[model samples]
Target: MRSMHSMRIASFRVQNYKCFVDTGEIKLTPGFNVFIGRNDAGKSALMEALSLRHTHNPHRSLETVRTPTSEPPSSAPTSVAYDLSPEELRQHLTALASFFLPTGPNASASVFATFRSLLETGDRFNADWANGVVVKADLAGLGGLRRDANRYASVLNLAHPSDVQLALQNEITGSYSSYGVVLANWLRDKAYAFRAERLGLGRCAAGPDKVLSPNAQNLAAVLNVLSSSNPARYKRLVEHVRIVFPHISGITSVIVEGSSVEARVWSIPLESERSDLSVPLNQSGTGIGQVLAILYVVVTSDLPSVILIDEPQSFLHPGAVRKLLEILRSYSQHQYIITTHSPTLITLTENDQLFAVRRQEGTNVSTVALIDPNRQDDLRMSLADVGVRLGDVFGADAILWVEGKTEETCFPELLRQLTKTPLHGVQILGVDSTDELGAKNAQRVFEIYSRLAGTASLLPPAVAFILDKEQRSETEIANIERMGRGMVRWLPFRMYENYLLQSACIANLLNAEDASSGKAVSSEDVQAWMERHGGEKKYFAPREPTAYSDADWPQHVHGAKLLHDLFNEFTDARVSYDKVKHGVLLTRQLLPNPSGALSELCKILDELIRGAPSYTE
Candidate 1:
């Protein structure tokens, strides 16, 4: 086996390929190389061109590669096969003559003399490049058998032209196998290309697969193969999937109902009372099939020097997306070329993985900005600090995406707590799985790593986020942070509302609401309120009920419920659930106070603002 990091497309040169009038040279490295470009910007075309070298079709024609230009190349480049000119034919014979010269085995005989004698007479009849001009061979005499094998040598008139023909028709040396010839065939095995734009992971076929299909219809079979062939690699694939969807217990191949072979991911709920569940790969998220298909190809194919993946970041959890990129990096022996629109994908990519691609207006030709080798790190870090996602630095905010409206409403209030005065400029916003007006995760600072990851990108620019810890597992949280989205903060209290529910704080709020209500509330009343409304599973839901007494009511009472009940118990102006946010805001006015939990949480929020990337209008 080759070293883990052995294959890479050092550089690529293409001409007359679709959309690419002619991309001169694209240098690549053995890692996650991302191509960031606009639609119709030739990103896909570049990937297609790279895939061309591995293609073998005798009938593949050059017409498909034409630039769609007004004038095509003098001749076309064919996909299936090539048609070599007479000049090209002579070069092959000459190369063979050089290798088989009168030496070694034929030390005294000088058999090559017969081959050179025939090369003197070349193609004088047909001249494609030079119209109406012809050059004849100089050969006067040669043996019949040797002269016939070098037929193109006479046809070319000993002239040389760029050869396109890949097939060899004859071997004059009378050898069934030649070192150069056999080695050339073996080299093709060292590299190949896989285009996955339209992979069909679910289109079922009853039988097992000899190899994975382009659409991944045979994904299950491939998974089975990988497991049997290399268990460690198979385990790594499962680990990658687990990072994307943490609930997954394992991945397996199953022959369902006798005919259909399927890849399935099984999930075991965090709760032991729940039974483990399994879903067919096709029935799972589209990203799952895509991720699995890619891993199967890269990990098991073992032949390709380069892998071309277009928009690989689509439909992937930000964690899975990073995991996929890391796989490409770890397998540094092979090269990866990827195109993407996801900023999350760009977030974790190192500077070298980036390639900013753009097409000139009204032109099919696209070009990549060459990052100067010397300034790559500085330039990359600078872009990252300024929040240029996937090479696009737009007008966005240095906002914070937090849970609950209280987080949003508490923004100005949070600053007041920390600074003793409200600070303006930085914004704090809230968004969730449900599409909210003005809540696009596009500029989200931190996306919650729940099933709601699909909607995470639909937010205004916080350019960073810190998901509140609730049912989230530590591993899941760490996986999300590893994706470089943002920090995940565990609330010091039961929830954000708990910050405002402290006994001392509640006592102070009651004092503000009613002078007579200034006295501390008994913990028994707080517990009573929780037991009453806690069935609804609001912010204060806990698995076990804990009793509380005076001075500790806030520890047990739901903050919003406490405020609601406060008005009913004392002051009479109706306090609705909506008004509790205002109540929380009011409570924050007394914060960065003596309360340890609320104050500490406030400091963390304050530091988040200070540390996250900031953008301008």
Candidate 2:
């Protein structure tokens, strides 16, 4: 079975259909293509448009599919136009020509030349051409053919005069109405639309039908045939399923004793001292059935196909979704057009093209934007890297910009402890330092925020910026606050690490790190080390130390440098304070019982929350 095909739908256009008044030809990739959008944004509408084109029922009305308008529906027909390659055109004509041309030496050559001339001359027939000439070749039809005979002379000339009369008498009585019926059946066989909600199947009549239905209603029969005829493929399918669902040991079929009916089921191996068990697929959970159906199509497809899947992550776990995408990509013989709302799905697959579909406000039209994956700041790639998207930032109720990655991780933990609930719709983002923002002044930060907020209304309405004090003088801090219009808040301490100056937390971290060496650092040892090193006059509060007790060392000392020095002094322990790793760990520890500095930080966070714009769920 050959998987690669020379023909494919290159592009398509949908006009006056549902939310699409005129979706100027949307191009598709030969491989993985994704359409991502919110609900009712016309992603599924595009899938239905493709379905309408290749469906078997010819009388399926376009009246219900047309966009609502005051005028009669027939005034502007709802139509889908598919642009095919010349090779596909040749294949369509060849199938049609087979019915008319006789079996002889130059018959094949004549058929090819006739269609080649039709294609080269741009005199190809329309969708209804075969209906008039072949289906209803009465006197009126013959008169119609004579009127257009010059355009199809090559085709008429290919047949002997006797063969032409015979074809008109016999072949015209065949079932097909148009040449498109050949292409339609071909496409119907090669296309599969997967809808999880409609994917349930029961016991099917036993037969050799190996073709899985679009919704997999015939899954039992298909599996039954595959297991007997192609056991290798069936085994491969089970292996792939087990990768996603480890408990599924093997697949088997149970035949009804007196009837020719079988049920496809899977066996689960023994676990936790329990015996193995077999469960019918219909009795299994939807997630399991969905995975089996998806894997069945993916493994058994022996031709180049178009697989339409909507929200593939609906019933499956994230891990399963990731594995399914990996399996789909490994089999590149098919083109996959998936509609999804899961950022996990969007970020996981290496899609050939991603289209962001959006319905226009105050209009029925839906528009699509092709997102370039190669861009430096592509939203999906950003989600993969940092688990955040610009769209997420915009959708958030309030934005809190922090200094770096360390602060981004720790602040959320701190806020959760203070508020006693997760902050809803508040996004904590990590950004560069003040020096990186602008060397001269803080005005550049506002400029960057304004530029982001200006793009397509995609920024949160309320935003706050916070950065480390970082040895900045009182005058510099005042200047930044003034230049930033009070939007920026500078930490009172030297850095965020200063709030994490707990001796017990530091000792526990060191002990955990040096557990293998049977070495430990006590809280007393940490406190004594801090006292000796932190009581220096240079580390005093208010820029001067009258006495050790009067000075606030944690407030004035460089917290990052102190931790680095402590790690150096503890040579026996295999512990090193990674700013991101240890910083978050220490913050989590301090959050339960905050020190004076941490208490003050909590107050600042409370004030920010109170000042932020309120939002309703």
Candidate 3:
């Protein structure tokens, strides 16, 4: 595997923390990384440690340094004992700092264990960005109340000089009078970590200043700001969300009768018509919104933070899962640590960064980098050796099919440029079309390709037939469509017809001198030729025309162009056998799957050609 950039955990070690008893260290890649483990595997615990949350109890004592005492100092030339040198002491401190720095923007800052714990709870919190302080308190603490009976209390009571309050509170017991002034001041300055969840849109805590609650209910206000002040940017964000959910045709923000702002998705019909099936954002599928929210945070946030997610793929459909993985992989440019049960995501990319977290007995947790290059290669090879196809292992994956040695030659390169999607299970097969068989022979080629695809259980891309459209009688044309029925698709113009039409267009555009000089030919002459040869001129014309007269062309050209134009219009297009064998070779390139309609046409053509007499009449 090729290394892109270097990012290291710097000083990550775990001993007697969570499930890890033996200390373990892991290196991190600079890009998107995946952590995989089964249930109860302590993966989350491992993430917490890396995030600077204390993995061990804070009460544990550090062993004090001892120095050797000089014996018989007076007699032994005043030998003296000393502790570790200042340099050694500095080295130890540097090691400690490295453990928390994390090799990024926040690597130098000291992380607070108390703040980390306070973040786990559902509440509002503040982080003093200026002072590097995190003040977290319960909802009640933010308000000016310390009533033990009130369900909603305030963090106001926590404000104070700690040593003085400790002494005073011990003496005063339940009285707030003595602690009032100190509690209020301390409460005003303390900060907290708010988990990004509980903050939906309405929850607000009364205090001097609330750090934008990561999970406080103030999220609604943020959304409101985005929707109103920067609607265009908000729309762009929503569009990014839509690419993952292609079925969601449009999303509009609306306030329901209850006056709550909500985002709704409108469904689009397969035929391009609109329908009303607007679902509220909150009520929408969890997977869609979860994936969207994660993306939104990664893109929108400015904080130097690592997002720790559990079961990121929950409720996500396979296709959506694939899309989500793509987005996540792209977002790896930022820092995020996600846990999932999805093998699809785990193996989504060959260069994915992976780590495995394992829990051991007696508070021992271990995390080891699982994205080793050699091991990944071994895993892939072992799978192939075991007769396991990647598609089978990964489910009915998408595939591209290219026909013939020529297509097999350059298809991958062309596809990479066109789609930008990674090629996973695409296969190339030769249909053996070199023989002098007519266009109907495409059925045989399709059968060979389809059978191989079927055996492999790889769903072919909408069939893109690269066969030529040949000259044929009505019976023969129908025979080809029948032959290709479900396997082949139609290409525009017969092979010779498309070239001749293009030739005619060039011929028409130039005058007699240009035509005679081989610079151009008479379009009218080509037009007249089609009229005499029982073909359509306008439909078969190579150049785009300002006007088309359907009545001017004959049956052969008209009928051929009709088939050609139909395939062009069809979504998920497949190619017809006739198109491949004889149609103008369209750019000498083939797409993955043509349209599904084309697939059906190919099947129909196959049946037609199979039953037709081998000896042409």
How close is every model to the real structure, measured as TM-score?
0.44, 0.49, 0.41
Q: Candidate 3: where is the Cα deviation over 4 Å? A: 1-11, 48-213, 216-219, 252-265, 268-277, 302-305, 330-332, 347-351, 358-367, 376-397, 401-617
Candidate No. with top TM-score: 2
For 264-315, candidate 2 gives per-residue lDDT tens digits of 4455453433333566677776777777777788799764567787777677
Candidate 2 C-alpha error for residue 554, in Å:
42
Superposed Cα deviation of residue 29, candidate 2 (Å): 0.8
- lDDT for each candidate structure: 0.48, 0.60, 0.38
- The residue ranges of model 2 lying beyond 4 angstroms of the native Cα positions read 1-7, 53-72, 75-176, 257-267, 270-276, 348-351, 374-617
Q: Model 1, 1-617: lDDT tens per residue?
A: 11122323455555555554455556665566777766666676666545443232221124343454535443313121112223433444443322322123222122344433333333211111111111111111222233222222111212223432222222234433322232223222333344434455753644534355554567777776677777898898787666555567788775666576667767864354332366777777777777777677666664444456776555654435554564555555456677765544443222255666666566555566544433647545434432443222111224555665456555545554364421222445455422433344322423333323346453334534545555555676676566544444545555566565544555445555556544555556544655565444443455443444434544544555656765566445433334433445455555546467666766777676656543111
Whose TM-score is higher: candidate 2's or candidate 3's?
Answer: 2
State the lDDT at 64 in candidate 2: 38
